[model samples]
Target: MIDLRSDTVTRPTEAMLESMREATFGDDSRDGDATVQKLEALAAERTGKETGAFMPSGTMANLVAMLAHANRGGEVLLEDGSHTLNAELGGIAGVAGLFYRGIHGKRGAMDPDALREAIRPVTRYHMGTALVWMENTHNRSGGAVLPLAHMQAVYGLAREKGVPVHLDGARIFNAAISLGCAASEISQYSDSVCFCVSKGLSAPVGSVLCGGAAFIERARAYRRMVGGNMRQAGPLAAAGIVALETMVDRLVEDHQTAKRLAEGLTRTDASLCDPKDVETNLVRVDVRKSGRRAAQWSADLKSKGVLVAPADLYALRFVTHRHISAPDVDAAVGAFAELWKKS
Candidate 1:
């Protein structure tokens, strides 16, 4: 089957598998595993941060960031369409114990003016803004990359307000590839950043949260509180090491394949998607015009050996990764085209 459902569906590479076999079996929670420390240091270096802590998933990393950065009842401001706000299952509020105000945005970028106005000082009548948040290669907006200028503006405003900034950079490498820059270049705008190796990088599992040494130290405590500690995680960290070293550069191919998929879908039906909006490995197809729900479209495509996920009631999200190729994209597009014709 052509699994366009999500990059999370990607399996580890042979190199990663071999590394896992040769990895140490040290307990990360007690004596501090050498392999885990190596992966954290590498992640920190790649993102230009002072230190890093490994987490089980991007959601936990993000939640730990919020917990470490803000007190309970503090407010977090992020783009309305961010994966943290929509897809992370409300961990921002329920687990981190923070209130969030979703700022108006376009293509996953929060308007600087709106963000500036929303930031407030603590008063008897109100809670102050505790943190500002950003997402790169935004998931819900067809994998749109936030322009550096936009990120700078937001980061500047937050800094002026004395609010810490956290970046949900689950697809940071993808954003970097699309922008022709290093991941650190994109991560530089925020005080803290998190990225997943399990996505396009094709690691079996793991995400890394990077920030100032003190901040990451605090995050490690929160990671333990949230049950994110993976004792004897050297094998997983070994795969992550291989992913960081080898999987990043080839991400451009996934971006190219995604663009091709978007172009083909638009050719079949203009209303489905605009190829220009696809900057990375995700394609958001508008199925509303087909007089059917996004779930129906997903089900229909699944039956034809192509799999996708509904982004919302009216949109379907297609993701490309190392497992997918040009012919796979064409076949998925053909399935979508067939469904379109019937509709």
Candidate 2:
């Protein structure tokens, strides 16, 4: 099947497999593994941060960031459709002991004026804003890339309120390629950032959280508290290192394929998707006009040898990665068109 469900389905490359075979197996939780340290340093250098700590997943990295940055009952301000609020299973409140205020946004960017109104100082009546959050290539917004100018404005406002910022940059490299800039250029606006190597990057497992040395040191303790410390994680780090070195540049190809798929779907039915909305490797299709739920569409397409995920009642999310090709995109589009005609 042409698996357009998510980039998380991507497998490791041969280079990553060979590196994992020869990787050092030192204990990371005790003395710190050499391979893991190397991977962390590389993650830090890429995101323009002083240091980084390896985590088992992006969810853990984000939870650790929240735990390290804020006290109990503090508030986190982020876009309403953010992955943290909608997808991370309420870890922000349940585990981190923080209250979250979802700021209204468009295409993953928070409204500057709305954000200005939301940030508050500690008072007996309200829990003050503790952290300002941002996400690049935001998942729920169909992989929308937040503009740098918008980020700067939000960061400036947060700084004025004496609040620190955290960026969920799981697809920062995808955002960088779409904007024609370095990942650091995007990450510079936030106090801390985390990115996953297991998604479009094609690493088997791992995410890295980067920030100031002291902040990362604190995050490491929180990482342990949240059960994120992997004792002998050198093999995973080895694959992540290879992913960082060799997999980033090719993400543009995935974006291109996604655009191709979107354009083709639009040609079949304009109500399905707008190609312009597809800025990266994800395509969010609106199937509300078809009088069929997205879950139904997903199952129909899967039966025709194409796989996709239902994002909501009337929306579907299609993701492209290294394994998908131009021909695969055309086939998926054809299958979708066939179903559209039947509907």
Candidate 1, pairs of clashing residues: none
Candidate 2 regions off by >4 Å? Answer: none
C-alpha RMSD by candidate, in order? 0.7, 0.6
Stretches off by above 4 angstroms in model 1 are none
1-343 per-residue lDDT for model 2 (tens digits)? 9999999999999999999999999999999899999999999999999999999999999999999999999999999999999989999999999999999999999999899999999999988999999999999989999999999999999998899999999999999999999999999999999999999999989999999999999999999998988999999999999999999999999999999999999999998888999999999999999999999999999999999999999999999999999999999999999999999
* Every model's TM-score: 0.99, 0.99
Q: Which residue pairs in model 2 clash with each other?
A: none
Model 2 residue 182 distance off true place after TM-score fit, in angstroms: 0.5
C-alpha lDDT (0 to 100) for residue 226 of candidate 2: 86
On lDDT, the leading prediction is 2
TM-score of 1: 0.99
Error of 2 at 331 (Å): 0.2
